[model samples]
Target: MMFDPFGDFDTNGYLQNSLRLKDPLEVKESEHLAFEASLEDALAYLAKRKSIDYKAVLKTHEILFSGFYHWAGKDRSELVPHLAVFKGSKDDPRHTIFERPDLIRRSVEYALELAANKKRFRERPGEVMGQLAFAHPFLDGNGRTILLIYMELCYRTRFAIDWSNTNKDDYLRALSDEIQNPFEGHLDNYLKPYLLDISSRDEWPEMIGGIKGLDGLDKEGITYDNLDNPEVQQLYKTYRSQRID
Candidate 1:
């Protein structure tokens, strides 16, 4: 989904093989519902836990990984034995998952602050993702977990993520820069263009009409209400134009 419409990347067939549901209706009714519910739980748990309970994140991780591994036919507990946090031996580059937990923590903290300070920013979602990725909190499903976290946050906060319009090369590159670079200059530079582009749109059709123009595949479970918001409508128009090109 990320690579196909926007890039020349080849399809892997992984999802086609893994998704065994019968039809689009089955997908919308069962798989998507379960997936969405699990995501909401994860995001709410992370948000409620961030300030009051350090253990909350780990508990949230357990639920998230367990559901993911259950779907994947793998053992969740074995993949991540403990709650990951910034500082300690986990920061060693040789260890892999624990390497640079501090950086992950910093990113999480910064994203959380942004959510708190900005009217448009989604709380818990981006921060949880930034935190989990930086910590490499789990051995498996980190990517999915982070993405779900982001989605749930966006849904709760009403800021839609333009995943359909996003370029995976650019998105992954920016994530890598934040994880690898000491100065972290490239990370912000990468996301800045996306932010500016979406915010630049001048006008849009009504939500009912505008969102109807999006690729059905791109809609996921995103609501017309999200598109109805003035700011979100602008973004929808901006992304729709990009999709057109």
Candidate 2:
């Protein structure tokens, strides 16, 4: 069996759960582990996809036990929006991320509005990603989910935002701005650097290379050089490294 780094036996999910609980033991540790793994995988897959499909989103939780808590149990008909409801208990530690239910709904609606207006105006993808995170929709995986969704949207619509250029401080500033003035100032500020980078046609090969390899590959495919512009010897090395008969 493929080993899951954040699985039932680990505390990664439990740590997240402890935030909302007065007594951390209130949450079932086993269930938290299972859900955490599923959520992480879903976020990772969504980040890599070119476009958002409700089908793929739904499938992310189909096999999990408590996943149905958020989605209507066996009700596959209702589409899951890229930014949607987080149905964890308020008393649970998970509530820390989403303190107000109204804010969650507002964030979802705002994200939908952003998506709808993406083509009408030249909006930076990073700005949208930042706004989604500000929404903090999901109790657990809001950051991961929003980033993936924003990237996927940009990849399909041709407004990719690479965070490689800016430091974490700048990125967080943009997100903070969105919370204060989501309609105008903050969104643009956070996204401006990323937008400039995208427009400039600069590539950050190292960060892209370091991304986790496609699932099931024997080699992780993480290397420092630009594989796209590999030297003759490097090409030969890469060719030899692949599993071949």
Candidate 3:
């Protein structure tokens, strides 16, 4: 089943988009265009911030996607608090489970806390990325939103990722493994070779927008269930008890 948390797909599309587009292809084109247009505004917003917190994360999503999504800045916790979102199926042992709605901010906050230790963040950027990706704060635009935030964090920390040098499928596989088996450095190993010196903030809009597969790490084949559902509750146990060597 598709992840339609809004429960309006039959009439409104995967999301209640700006132009009421019901076709997936059309919605994607329009949404991608809006995202391209907003990159500068989003970066400008981040550039003004003296410090970042969970609230800054929300605002960055708003600026980047408010043109396309009516529910742009709001997270799943506020919009669909009872639903627990996942990739693949809840019953599958291999599925990717995001943080529960109630814990979304806490997860992002933890990522920010980890980022505060600049040394740890630089040494294990994948761990930081994995944590934020697990937060899964928004209904859409997550990959781009998180990239912007991650870029800001990198800029502040004096390091950068050579995104162009990485492969999408490999990066995503590593990220999924990282979320499922966190702190063991699965993603860190994947990202280490791509780490490089920081680039100018002004170069980001063109450089990031020109890149391919930025959205590949985001929503696709997603499904959701009531938090009270037994299987859904069981799946969260993996996250609750996660630790890896």
lDDT of all the models against the reference? 0.38, 0.40, 0.86
| Rank ordering of all candidates by TM-score, starting from the highest | 3, 2, 1
Q: What is the lDDT of residue 19 in candidate 3?
A: 87
For model 3, residues 1-245, the per-residue Cα lDDT tens digits are: 33477888777776788788776667777888888888888899898999999899999999888998989999999999999988887677788898999999999999999999999999999989999999999988999999999989989998888787788889889999999989889999999998888757867876696666774346577888899988778767756876433
- The sequence of per-residue lDDT tens digits that candidate 2 reaches over residues 1-245 is 21111232253333233332223334444434544556445555654655554344334434332441333112211322222222232233322122133344455455555665666324545445545554553333334344445545555555665456655555555664554344556656656656532432224233332333211121111111122333523433432343121
Best by TM-score: 3
Would you give me the overall lDDT of model 3? Answer: 0.86
After TM-score superposition, what is the CA distance of residue 115 in candidate 3 from its true location, in Å? 0.5
Write down the worst ten-residue block by lDDT for model 2: 214-223
Q: Which of candidates 1 and 2 is the stronger one according to TM-score? A: 2
Off by over 4 Å in 3: 215-217
Better of 1 and 3 by TM-score: 3
Clashing residue pairs for model 2: 19-93, 20-92, 20-93, 21-93
Worst 10 residues of 1 by lDDT: 200-209
